[model samples]
Target: MSPPRVETVLIVDDSLVQRLHMVGLLRQCGIHGILEAVDGNQALELLSALDTLPHLIVVDLEMPGMDGVEFILQMMKRNVMAPLVISSNRDLSLICSVENMAQALEIPILAAWKKPLTKQHLAEILHHSPDRPPPSHSTPETHKEASSTGAHELALAISRHQLLPYYQPQIDLKSGTITGVEVLARWPHAEKGFIPPDHFIPLAEKHRLIHDLTLEIAGQAFAQAAHWRRSGVHLTVAVNLSPRLLDLPDFVSEIDALLQQYQLPAEQVIWEVTESSLAADLGIALANLARLRLKGFGLSIDDYGTGFSSMQQLSRIPFTELKIDRSFVHRAHQREHLRVILQSALDMAHKMSLVTVAEGIETLEDWKLLREFGCNLAQGYFIAKPMPGETFTGWVKTQNTRRHGRRGS
Candidate 1:
C-alpha cells in the first residue's frame, strides 16, 4: 500500500537541525511541500504570506521567542485551523500542558511526541485521522454554518419543544457490558439539520433558557429510562446539568417531581456536572447536590481535570463518580505524559472510593490500556457516538452479540 498523501506541511522550530530533520521525514512520508520557520514569529509571517494553510504544523514547545503556546494562541486569533503536532524534547509535562492549552483554544492538535522526531511518529501523526471533524475551508456551506445564531432563535426552539435528547452508551470496561448511557442534548433544526450543542448551549444560557432546556432533556431521559426498565434493560441514565439551574429555588424538588412523574428511580439516574458549575452559586448548588445525593441519585464530577479546583470540588462534594476528560484519556496509550496523568487520576479516584470513568476511548490500544488500569466505565467514539433514544435497545443487542463472539473466539 502507498503512504498517506499529505501535500504540504509547515515545520516550526528554532533549531536549524531540527527543521532539516523534520523536512527529511516529511519527504520520506511522501509529503513534499515543506515550509520551515525558525520561530513562532517567522511561522506567523509565513502563514500571512501564503495563500493557503498547510495540511499539518509540527512545532517545538521551547523556542527562542514567541513559543509554541503563544503561537497557538496567535493561531487561534488569526483563525488558523491547520492540524498541529507538538515535537518537543522538553519535559513531557510541559508538552502535555501545551497540548491541553491548544485544545482548549479549539486548535486541532493531532499528537504530542517527545523530541528527536522519528519517522514512525511522523507517519503515525500524518496518517492517522484526527478524532474531530477536519477544519472546513471557506466553502459556502461552511460559511453559512459559521454565521451567527441568534439567542432568540434558540429561545424559540426551546419554547417549541424542538430540542431532542441523544444517548451515548457507557460500557463496563472489564465485563464489556453496557453499564448505562450519558444523555446529550441535540437540536434538530429544520433548516440546519442538527445544530451542535456547542452552538446553541451558550445561547440557551445567555437567553435564560437553560432551565427549560435542561428540564426538557431530563424529562426525555427519565421517561426513556422508565421505558427501558419496563423492557428489562435496567440501565442507568445520566444527564448533563447546567450550572445555571443549580441555584433555582425549586431545582431539586422539580427534578424529583420529574423522576416521580416518569416513575424512574433516583439511583438509576446520574447527574453530570463540571467542577466549575458548582462555583456559580456555591451554597445553593452544594445544598441541592447534597439533597440529590441523599435521595440516592448518582453525582459525577464531569471533565474531572479541566476545572480550576478539581481536587477541592472532589473533596467537598458527595460525588459518586469521576470522569477523566477526553484530552487525557484519548492518547494515554501513546503519550507517556498522558499515561502518567491518567494513572494518577485513576489512583486518586480509587483512593476516594469513587467509580472511575475514562471518556474518549477512541483507539483499541487506549481502551485496552484503560481496562488494564481497572477503569470502571468507558465511553466515546470507539464504542459509539450518541444515538437517538429509540435506537439504544438495538445497540445494546449488537454490543451483546459482539461480546459473546469475542468470548467464543
Candidate 2:
C-alpha cells in the first residue's frame, strides 16, 4: 500500500531551531510543502500572500509579537479555517488555555504537544488530519478580550443561557442501538462561539455557580428529552452533577421540579457524579444521592477507576451505573493490564448489579473488547461526538437505519 497523501503545512515559531526541528519531523511523516513564519504577524502576512493556504499550521504559544493566541484570533477574523497544532514548552495548563481559546474561536485543533516534539506525535497528527473536518468560517458577532479564567464572564454566560448542552450518544453494544445521550455543556458565546467546559467549569465551582450551571444544563437536557419522547424516540439523558450541587439545601427538590416541569420521568434522567466528588462530605452527598435514587433517577459513578476510594464510594452511593475511565478503555484491546483493569471494573459493577459503561472507546477494537467484557453501555467519539439538540434527532435516525441495514445484510 502507498503512503498517505501529504498536505501543505505551515510552522509558526520565533526560534529558528524549533522551526527546523518541526520541519524535519513533518518530513519524516511524509509531509512536504512546508511554509515558515517567525511570528503571528508574519504568519498572517504569509497567509494573505499565498494563493493556496496550508492544510495545517503548527504554532508556538509565547512568540514575541502577535503570539499564538493572537494569531489564532487573527486567523478567525480572516476566516482562515486551517487545523492548528500547538507545539510549546509552556505549562500544560497554559497550553490547554490556548487550545480552549482556539476552540472557542472555532479553530480545529489537531493536537497540542509540549515542546521537544517527537516524530511519533507528528505522524499521529498527520494520520488523524484526513478524518477531521475543516474549521467553520462563520464569525462570532464580536470578539471579547480573551481572559484565561473568566468566572464573572461565565456567570453572565449562564444567565444568558449561552452555556448550551450538547448531546453525545451512548450505545448498547449487543443491540447496536443508541440507548441514551450524555448532556455535555458548551458555552456558545456571542463573541467566542463555543467555549468548552474546562475553561469555565472550575471557575463556576469556585464561585458557587456550579449548581446553577448544572441545573441550566439539566433543564435544557430535560426539554430535549421531552421533545424526543414526543417525537416517538425515547432516550435517557445523562447529566453530570457537581459535588458542590449536592450540598445545596434543596438540590433534590430542584431536580424534581425540573423533571415535573418538563413532564419527563425521573427514570429517563441519569445523574453522573465523579468518585472524587463523592469523597468529600459523603454523609450529606450520600443523603442527597439517596433521595435522587428514591425519586427514580439513574445515578452513575462517572470516571470509575481514576478516583480515590472508588469501590467504597460505589458501595455507599446508590449508583445504578459505573462508567470506566477512558485511560483504561482507550487501548484495552491490545494491553492485557488495561484489559484486566477494565474487566475487573465490569465484574465489580456486575456483582453490584450496576450497569457498566466504558468511556472513550475510540476504536472498533476497544468497542469489541468492551462488548466481550460485558460492558452494558459505551460512549465516546467512536459512537458519536456531542451534537446540538437540533441535529440530534436526525443523527439518531441515521444511526438506527445504519444499524438495521447492517443486521439485515
Give per-residue lDDT, candidate 2, residue 254: 91
Q: Report clash pairs, candidate 1.
A: none
Clashes per candidate (backbone, < 3 Å): 0, 0
Candidate 1 per-residue lDDT over residues 184-262, each given as its tens digit? 9999888878787887888788878899899988998898889999988899898888899888879999999999999
Evaluate residue 17 in candidate 1 and report its C-alpha lDDT on the 0 to 100 scale: 89
- Candidate 1 has an lDDT of 0.86
Instruction: Extract clashing residue pairs from model 2.
Output: none
